[model samples]
Target chain A: MVRFIDGDTRVLVQGITGTQGSFHTRLMLDYGSRVVAGVTPGRGGMVVEGVPVFDTVAGAQDRHEIDASILFIPARFVLDPALEAIDAGLDPVVVITEGVPVRDTMEIVANARLRGTTIIGPNCPGIIKPGEVKMGIMPEQVFRRGNVGIVSRSGTLFYEIASHISRRGLGQSICVGLGGDPVVGLDFIDVLRWFEADDETEAVALIGEIGGDAEERAAGFIAGGGFTKPVAAYIAGRTAVPGKSMGHAGAIVQGDAGTAIGKIEALRDAGVAVGDLPGDVAEALGGLLKG
Target chain B: MKLLEHQAKKIFLDYGIRIPRGELVDSAIKAREVANGLGAVAIKAQLPVGGRGKAGGIQFADSSDDAEMVARGLLGTEIRGVEVKRLLVEEKLDFSDELYLGVVVDRRSRSYMVLASREGGVDIEEVASTTPERIVRHAVDPVFGLRDYHCRRVAGLLGYSGKEMFSLASVIERLYRVAWEMDAELTEINPLALTPEGFVALDARLNIDDNALFRHPDIVEALRLGGSSDLSPREREARDLGLTYVELDGDIGIVGNGAGLTMATLDTVALHGGRPANFLDLGGGASAEMIEAGVSFVMGDSRVKAVFVNILGGITRCDDIARGLVMARSRMGTEKPLVVRLVGTNEEEGRRLLESQGIPTLETMEEAADRVVSFMGGV
Candidate 1:
């Protein structure tokens, strides 16, 4: 009953021979993810941690019914792998590689949209559902089975908050890292729509940072009665100066709209429970649940 | 990574974009020789970001002696945190018209946009915000490439006519090619001047996509030559290890689990009157070794009087981080104070581990920031 991934979702790993890909594939497999096949252009017929490898995504898809794919290719080859996966009919592609060229990412995102395929990140940690299946690079031990649906732009921050919720016995239904790229595939509102429809997800915890009008847009959706789920949110980079570019291409505070103050105020005005600290996320959700 | 004006202009010249004849010099003697070769010259201090003219980084000189004096005064000065190590001495020209030309990847639209204007020598953002009608924008198709007609239309919108129109159009096409070929995120030629002689780029700025560096070996070497190696040693190490680290002007060093948390830590610090010194993301699946390395890296910076470790456990366990912190402290013998906010799996065990070592642990990010700020004598 998890949001994006579950036991039934078959997965393919691109660049499976790479250190990061292989390492996280093992973790995902251990956490019950149905990792069906692996793809590495010249290394066909090899097995990485028991997952069958093929020369191309098309070759792997022929052997397995892949519902989703996780790309571990380097920044330079990110587009090629993603295009290959999408062309092979992978419905949702989760890109974990960072530093992808902005031009290349724009093209890939547009192409994915045209194809009616979902792309998670070109520079982000993947998604996970506690006690079910794990995708991307998040550690598996800290998560626990629960009803809070989590979404965030920062991978590490999402994992930390997931752990906090798990520790407080406030388990999560699913946690999605929408990525930190400026032009990501899915935004806050998109993930909120998914969480709102999921029966297992009783409440939502949204972790946002300074940059873009994503938070503002999400607040608008809530204000417009877009969802009835109790929502708890945390906005980061409050003191970040405007016009200064952060490490993540998407983490810049553009003009006056993307500031933390603006986002926090908007979310508060929308009647969403806003937590002040990472640890307070559980308390905020609890308050929302009570209301 | 931002390049100085001279460096950007050199790349522009390589791409056959017409620019004023110029030579960058580190000393006043070289500046005098270059200025002597060309009668009236412009002495521009080479600094990395924009608004340099308003910062008094550029000056006009009628003679070689005046140019040398200007260069001497600028060479050792600091502008906008960047030291003026060199001066770009170029031939001054009598221009009939000035225009703005730039190519940038618009994230909102997910396309490469070409912007041109009749008004020049001003910030493009200000122009776009204020006089929106004066600027013209065109989105280029990557598959078709930027066509000559596209350039002509942009020039026409800028009120270009005669030889000035044709020459400006040619320059626009060439610059667009450079922007595409070099994988540039932003390429700007402000004051795209048109003189009686010909059209020339008076000022240039090119920001290459860092992801494309592996494909462009030549630009990697060119970047190395600008004496712009300003990143700290720890930051360089972090980059080599495939981590994202940005140094800031603050006293509290932050090492966090995610980019969001790191940024939140920075905000929390500032909200509590404590400045954050840097953003160091250890990424997800942070092992004990990576945590140890991240800790030592932050402690190495003398500007960081205190360190704040913020982690939300997820798959990365609190106990694992606690062990890494202890190991790093023992190995580096860090005397600088540390405040940690650890929550998630094994929280109690992690707290006990740190408490046994007499290390302070805060329950929340706000309290950790407050403790660090208070320890540093209230910011």
Candidate 2:
């Protein structure tokens, strides 16, 4: 039983006429996601991959019972689509578009919080519940239905780490890409709390990079007895030097607060099984599960 | 997007924050003339990073002739890998009190934090570490912004009183406004000095968000002007194509999936004595066309003796990247050394596609970097 999404969840595609949205919508439907409708604004009355299209998210909701939405809108128009989806009463919205301005993301995040809607990312790869629904760009073949919940900041890193777990015959209950942007909606602790409460998730894998104190904060939460399930973690950019800003503007370690070594040390001290290499992540989790 | 002191001061001036009179001059002769005209002047190297004074990027010239000599020596010299093309000649101020003020986006709290301190002209990090009470911080609401009351509260924390308190508070307000209006990620005044004349922003460093450039055409144009002209032709081409590329001191030029991977690749190269010639992110979901452009850009750099293609395909399909690589190689037609590490969906297909075309494929990112550095003769 994957968390956040399953066979019961009805999905709608925003910007369904776009190449990526159409392709992924078809993929999601084939993977057993109950994709009910698509929204293309002005391209209404059309059909994409057997899903009916409408002008707005409200129109799409009127036509189909869209419990959740996966947005594929361009970066500039991401905020509008997300707000529209939330306004239309979509429970959870997965935003796959990257490069949305931080200001726009802040507004979207604030609005989503106000409306009690879950907005995943404006720069993320979206989420996937193996064997039930794949709402993101993750390789479906690599993920299997299992009890390990995964959350990551980097999309590609998530897939690679998930592949490592999949090779060990241990699949994920649900994998969420929180996006690498500084102003992304959900934090590591937010996703961790969910995984902690989910009965399906016996353990969790957290993929973090150098930047922000999110990992350190998550470690504090775990150390404070906020989480009972064992967490296997891997922090990237360990060998990276300080004062060099990474690609994500938010990932810059200006002072001593944000560093890979600092984060790894904090997590290690917090009783997390930290993996030194990508392939070793599964082994770390296996050890934790055994314990 | 780090703005030099003079450029940052210009933004500060626009926001009604007072700054010492300054003029940017490129030649030593001009520097001498400006210094002489200003009477008592501070000669500062126009660089993007901090610790300029400690790095010898800043000097106080007693006479116009001395200013000229220093300016000539600085221009065309490299400071922290960035060439000093110009010098800012500013009138030095006699300060009654010195303070520190800055507005930086606190990523942890997801808020714009205003940092103020009565003790100025020193590194804020050092201040935070030693006497943490000296640094007073207040998170500004993005919606309401930095109000007068909020500034006063911060000023009170810094132990300011009377006119000095009022003046410092106003400066904080103005700085916060500039930071918000300009979409700046960081706006710092190292020494917000309280002179006999008034409160002045003695040193300024502003870093604007690169993503918000479209809305700020003026700032964008100003940044372009301040930018170095020593950029490679391919780098210029890539910039014109709207890709973010920054050259480093690395021989293994990397073009990758995202900014994070590009930087990680740089770190890997640096660990192996290979300086990455540039940080080029083809962006997520790069097509064959973009890859061709990226390859051309990387190969265009003479310093880049080798190229590393590190891709983690998710939404960006490995096959699509392979097609781009094949297209880029054929189009460029230069057998410049290449190392490719493609992982994720359709990785095997991507490997086969590249191998069929005789391009070398590595199993891991570390191996690819090492191989490229080795190919460059231990660069």
Best by TM-score: 1
lDDT by residue (tens digit), candidate 1, A121-173: 87778888888887788777767888999989887667667777877878889
- Give me the candidate number with maximum DockQ: 1
Residue-level lDDT tens digits of model 1 in B187-300 = 999998878778789999887877777878877887787656546566677777666788788888889876787887887788788888888877666888889988888888
TM-score of chain A of 1: 0.96
Compared with the true structure, all predictions reach lDDT values of 0.83, 0.80
Write down the C-alpha DockQ for each prediction. Answer: 0.49, 0.42
TM-score of chain B of each: 0.87, 0.79
Q: Alpha-carbon error at A91 in model 1, in Å?
A: 1.3
The lDDT of model 1 is 0.83
B252-331: candidate 2 lDDT, tens digit per residue: 77887776566667767776777777777776778878888787778877777778988877667888889988988887
Candidate 2 Cα misplacement greater than 4 A, ranges:
A1-3, A59-64, A86-89, A239-245, A255-257, B27-38, B61-78, B81-83, B228-283, B292-312, B328-355, B358-379
Q: Which ten residues in a row have the lowest lDDT in candidate 2 chain A?
A: A238-247
